[model samples]
Target: MKNKFVQILVTGILVASLPACKQRPDNDAARAKGTGAPTIASTLHFADEHTTATYETAINKFFKNGLFRSGFNGSYLVAKEGKIIAEGYNGFLDPVTKTDSIGEHDAFHLASVSKTFTGMAVLKLWEEGKIGLDDDLSKYFDKFPYPGTTVKMLLSHRSGLPNYTNYLEHYNWDKKKLVTNLDVLTSLYTMHPPLQFPTGKRFSYCNTNYALLALLIEKVSGKAYHVYLEETFFKPLGMTDTYVFSLDKAETAMPSFEWNNRRYGLEFMDLVYGDKNIYSTVRDMLKWDEGLRNGNLFRQSTLDSAFQGYSYEKAGARNYGLGWRLTEVENGKKIVYHNGWWHGNNTVFIRLLEEKATIIVLGNKYNRGIYRSKQLCDIFGDYRQSNKTFQELENESSNGLAAGGSQ
Candidate 1:
């Protein structure tokens, strides 16, 4: 039965990866009017029976002994060479109610991982000649306080803007009132908060950077951030179960829980979409990973910029890319990935770019074990000897020690 399940799963992934007969009109129009870049399909690599069984055994052992035993409540999917090798959904959508078990199609808040989409959307605008990466914030917003910061700086988290999460609460904004992207901007303008550091001096991983990037996307594209993402990436990629969270969808969205299984209530910061609030399933995230990998979404140069390391001021293997976190590993290879935490939600999205392996774990219930999913890199390639293990890097991020770590 297990072997049969693996075969069926692999076959389904193979079928999904193929080109569809019908394409969305807007997506086709965007591709034509935009980059005009050709899509490059990855060479599919299906593991043999023995290899597949080996992978399943190791993955099952890891989850059963590690995550599952530690009270993980979410879904996980592992893919190698663009093929689904092993996947599972465990626990309930609402732990308190003990109902609605999690499934493949359920979406959990991506937290900072949502930055990946915001970053790419800005780059997409850049590719279309609608915006320049170096354009100043003053160009878009009247009386913008930050003079030197540019679109590129925001994408790479080098803008040095104070984090809204910190300032909004510190300034004693009404806790009952939900904050929006524009409200964040208004507060920045009115308060004129001191910059964390001079623009472009260093990388600081501020949520305010991406929040403003979302506004930039809307200003340049003349579409709301959520609308732009849906029309540009999600719909085109067929990520049916993904979306930017809104109050209207709140009731239907999956609820997050604490480590003790207590459900977390919504807060003032919950409404903001760019810095976080993207809800996506593991499979939908895989489609996103494959979409970016296949070169169908943007020009090769654009994608390269998004994944390239931008911060070297600090002596460390971990660095921030445009919308992703990177870990420089042995043999000059880099693990391009992002992990997210917001409320009780923790998400892991990893891509071993060279080996074409992907690891995705989304848990509505907080579990530090979720970050350890990066350790699975060892199963795909020679990532064992990196200066810092992926697990350690993620641990820092989860504890809010790393820049933009605790999103």
Candidate 2:
């Protein structure tokens, strides 16, 4: 059973990674066209084409093989055209506490993927006329380098700013040291030089883009990043569990575990959360995914711009939009995705716009969740709606004489 699932996962990953999607973002937001970009959902789609029994077979195979280890467990939810079709959770929540961290219900850390929330927060502020897409970022920066960077440029990661010098270059940051939000700004201003590329000139993934934007959220809104997200996005949408966490002390936020010959839980958490502690359960994430797809958080017109991809060059691999990733998958299918990693915990959010389906896989290791998500996508490939039973999976396991897990 494990072998079959692993094979499905590996094959799925190879197949999915082969092609790059083409993305186009409206460079001029000032125009009435309002960031003209490709639509996210297909005009027509079959429910079964998004997810089906075949994909269920693949998903079952993934879960049966102890897909997530170190108790690096996960929660999975599949929805079709704004309806909940399937949801499940597996793995351990607290090793010391021995909690059952199920999927689609329990929250986990989003890591950098939390940037998605940050992105939404920024956009919310913009919609309220509290901020502008093209406002000079440095005008409010405590001690900024480039004075002309805009919110739009930062959202598209086109600001050309350096991310983190103190943490990245310093090597041994004293964990005991309290790295205030201002500390981050000081580090960037002092260590990193001018923007990597001219504003609105190119594409590069930089955390500084959002980290600085986090400040903008505070400066313009008169609220902390965490508080702003809670009020504008989370509270409004009823995401009771999700929040912008700034871990002051070592608190029990993300649960850790070891699996598939790796320690996934804590180390993975660190990467996603940085040193600051932040958390969310799988359940909260499922709610988030649902809200994003259903447009519960933003107007259709607004979300259209938020999820669209922007690129500097006219023709190349697709680029990133404000907070979402836009790409086209196999057979001209459009896929929107974003991933989170922190303290050894990882999660992947995969939404196939053509099918109007969403796939979420969160794990403890680096490659595990990504691998499973792609494989699950392949099995589901073009499937729209899925109908399968756990008993069927059990029967497959029994007849195949297989038990998953790398031996």
Candidate 3:
């Protein structure tokens, strides 16, 4: 009878302390032990009531009016500490009918932002010891033309690969038919064209890096690239609506747009995977951001490798990480992000680490204003804008090569 009373008392105490314990800081050691692997320590600084109100007001006033005037059309979400503070949508899913208004359920093509997913997938494999970061392409593809290029170089955009799209004019191919990653690889391996720069020379963002990475993922896993992503990341994470675009669905898929409301039809290039072709909703993307933050998929060290800048000799506040673009301010704060442009879609996914904020703006209509989504970071802290990145990418995108380069 005494032992039962003692057990009840202990249970009561445990229940009473649960809420308070949850509020305590999760340090690295605690998180590692709790998750049974490396996990990111929460630096989430919750916005006070006053701060949240201020941010809400700023977002509404600045984005709502300014974006509409600038012809912005798509879904936007601003979140902190896994809670959304502000979200807005102003666009039509079917531009012809002008009836289906863009909503939370609508999924936009992620375009270049898909690279982040590919990057994380590779890191997961690397963490598993199935692949090495420094392993050469020759290890996987015995016929790969480039000998010295390592997997790490491709991840960091230092591989100096030439954009494959540039050769489309010279290579004879069916324009109406879709091109596969293997097709691109075969062309590069046969042509043996001059690279944009020497291997491991400097930062030159190219879609070829990811195209090869996708092939590498397939070669190593013995599964299709899309299959691996679905089995490994999407299904487990409960991202029911998120998926790689399929040609069968292209006829009924959501269409892209120009600022003038001109619709852009699906092209053969839509078949590619690594650099583009991801489709997801704002809520699902927020779930992805949270997954990375919580270290649900990869170890904290693997994730840290994705954000760490590998090209320091370059002249700029901006640097290219494994699959994402990074900007380091003088204050030592880092802004991790990736932007996408394909057809008429223009998107930005910004992760504010120290402030624990995420700004994701995905527009199916062609509008440079979506790049201004980074300005949302000013509310969290003094974020130095990557003016060159936005302008150069926007300019280059006019020719169909985005910062991520559809080629």
Number of the top lDDT candidate: 1
Q: For model 1, name the residue pairs that clash.
A: none
Among these predicted structures, which one has the highest TM-score? 1
- Per-model TM against the reference: 0.83, 0.70, 0.81
Candidate 1: stretches off by over 4 Å: 1-51, 385-407
Write candidate 2's Cα lDDT for 1-407 as tens digits: 12222222212212242132111123222123332111111111223522333244445455554453323355555555544334444434443343332323345666566777778778878778788887786667754677677888888888887656334445455555555556667766665555677777888877767777777888888987777777766776667766555443236454544444344432211422222234665445556766776766677767778877788486643558887766644345556777765545677777776566667666543444343454455433442222434344434534542223232
The alpha-carbon lDDT assigned to residue 380 of candidate 1 equals 60
Task: Name the 10 consecutive residues with the lowest summed lDDT in model 1.
Answer: 1-10
Candidates ranked by lDDT: 1, 3, 2
Q: Using alpha carbons, what is the TM-score of model 3?
A: 0.81
* lDDT for each candidate structure: 0.77, 0.55, 0.73
List residue ranges in candidate 3 displaced over 4 A: 1-51, 386-407
Q: Per-residue CA lDDT of candidate 1, range 136-249, in tens?
A: 889999868989988889988899999998988888899999999889889998878889999989999899998888888898899999999999999999899999999999
Candidate 3 lDDT over residue span 267-384, tens digit each:
6667878988889977778888888888778788888889999999856779989999998887788999999999899999999988888998888889998888887676667675
